[model samples]
Target: MPDTASDTTTGYQVLARRYRSKTFGEVVGQESIAETLERAIDRGRTAHAYLFCGTRGVGKTSMARIFAQALNVTDEQAEEVAVGDAILRGEDMDVVEIDGASNNGVQDARDLIANASIRPARSPFKIYIIDEVHMLSNAAFNALLKTMEEPPSHVKFILCTTEPHKVLPTIQSRCQRFDFRPISVARIAEHLTAVLGSESIEADEAVVLRVARLANGSMRDGLSILERVVAAADGRLDAALLERVLGVPPEDIVKDVASAIGAGDPAATLRAMATLLAEGLAPERALDGIAERFRLLLAARVCGDDPALLGTGSEESAALVEESSAFEAEQLVHMIALCDAAGGRVRVSASPRAILDAAVTRMALSERFARAASLLAGDVTVSSGATSKKKSLKVADSTRPTPPARPASPPVIESAPEAAPE
Candidate 1:
């Protein structure tokens, strides 16, 4: 009989597993890592010690579990071990996962080494999954290193950690390392849709996408957000509920503001912001939303390989890259810093609109106006104030490759035109 744990009928299926990609074919993105691991398994060149490193919510732990499931198998009832099962049963005994923070002691390391000597009771080899191995104390690491160098031929070890630098260099040298990258927002969105559908949850795609973007490339985080949305959506998983629950501003709304800013329309930008405020959007959340989008745009613009990871549309991606090409990297860096500083203040300020407005005002003039002032002083002769002024340029919401010049708009003098030149 198949394991009773395989039951999918109940709502107990967490988003992580409901959306878990068991085989390499199912895992989206991370093609390079997957392909390399798959090849290692196929060729029997698998290393005795393996190090899987990446950020939390990425696939370090999941991939570790997958590797354990792949290289070690079992007889349904007995302790017989097999290889190449192609599926990892969640309850397999051959696979033991250790939480390093809780179990990082010399005693625990010794116990693991002792267990490593014993052959798989029913599977081909006993697989140990040590998560957050960097937390292991120096003594614990030393105890484990001896066994790691020459564990029994049938025994395999997989260590997953977010901070590989803390791991002893000797341990790192012993393992075949594969770096897992954060999942793209599109991939996370795609996964969320499949998981929500599997659970028969009634949620809008926009809501799901919002949670995915908030997850910030962590599949685990995305799932957690999905679970929250499922509970708070009250049977109608709309975008508003998701944002409210997460204390986040809607990505689309932020994109609209970015679009307005990119188009160099001060009136339109302020109008959109006002609409958001009128609709009861928190000023702090609003600025945070803008900050997130701008940061993502900065990343996408610099790294042209994956815009989807940045939650950027195809058209927007093109525009953003074009905008990014205008300034030296330092300009974007400074803009993000200013927005971040403003966001920090807005989060705590009673008047968030004022704070955000100050941020946007600074962004527009921080570099350009200063430079223009210098030029007017006859210190320089540069004529490209238009390019330097768009702190919001990286979002690329405009249709043109680059936004139109904004120097055409001048503040009204109010005074008569020099009183007919005196």
Candidate 2:
């Protein structure tokens, strides 16, 4: 499956290319659409133009390439290709893949238009697969529109883009639009398992999940991250080393921080910070990890009942989501904001430890910040609530109340010292 051989080039295929889906069957999370395309071709109802639309790493380009191969398919008696070795090769016959970002100009398109008049050189049909199709210039799109409106019977056009909304509706109307969904974590995990085992490299499931989680629903992005991790680890991976390499704050740290937050124990939270500092974790990174957890909690609350909508298939994250209800959404938002701001500052600060200390103190003590706001607003009810809370906590009455004026003690102490000097 790899394009590389010998020491001439890097042996590593790079996760995206190495694990690329050569066939519709290998495409994860797009089975229904793949089946539809297969049936369409089988039934001789295949459209001349197709638009594969989705976010990046969702297999838009890959599907376009596959369809292009399908147009020129000849290995089997079947009309469409089955993504075999021959189809995967994408030889210099009828199938062609072009980057739209660079070839979106009218001149380039005019060249394509000039060539469209010609018939397929050898294969059944000439297939033009254009990626990032939305990048085409207005003039180029206009030129494409004419061809798409009425193309030769032997030509097939496959347009792919992450931003299909930018594409002209005229072009869209002429094509069969297929939306590619983001790859699920389960799918990414499965692919990673196959790829890793093939390479004879063993890694923890949590490490793979972390790579997948950071990918943010992009299979290409996930693979890219996984490649980086593999390279950084020098072959074998340890959970702590992997987390450190990827800048992921450890899972235990996140859980501890969140649990401390739930219990409202500032000291316990500060102790957790100290433990991370002992582990050689930077204050800035620790803060970022804390922020990431709170962000996760925010997402958990949003997708309270729907695990699928969360776009993750991690059991730990699912458990985190279930346990996340103990904290209010506003609390997570508040902590996330604080951690983000603190992390930003800590990164630039010469004394990150001091900044971390102050940040934790700020978060812990900030609960009473609204008391001052309430006082200024002359809201008696809020002041009473504060007083009652302090009473419930058994803090001293003197400490709870606003401080009275410091009277004549200063003058008396100065006189006694002056008297001794005289």
- lDDT per residue for candidate 1 within 1-422, as digits (tens), equals 11222566654666566566666666666778878888988898888889989888787776777677767643453433333333254466678778999999999999888888878766777888888999999999999877889888888888999999999998999898888888888888887777766666777665766677778788888888788777666677886787678767665667667666555566667777776666567776677677676676677667863556556456666766765554445656776687778878877888877878766666655455667766566454335645432234334455557766678777777855555555
Best-matching candidate per lDDT: 2
lDDT of 1: 0.72
TM-score, per-candidate, Cα-based: 0.70, 0.73
Model 2 alpha-carbon miss at residue 105, Å = 1.4
State in Å the error of residue 362, model 2. Answer: 4.8
User: lDDT by residue for model 2 over 269-362, one digit each (tens)?
Assistant: 7888787677677788788777777777788876674544444446755777886886778777888888888888888989889988878766
RMSD per candidate (Å) reads 15.7, 14.5
- Backbone N/Cα/C clashes per model: 8, 0
lDDT at 384, model 1: 64
Worst 10 residues of 1 by lDDT: 78-87
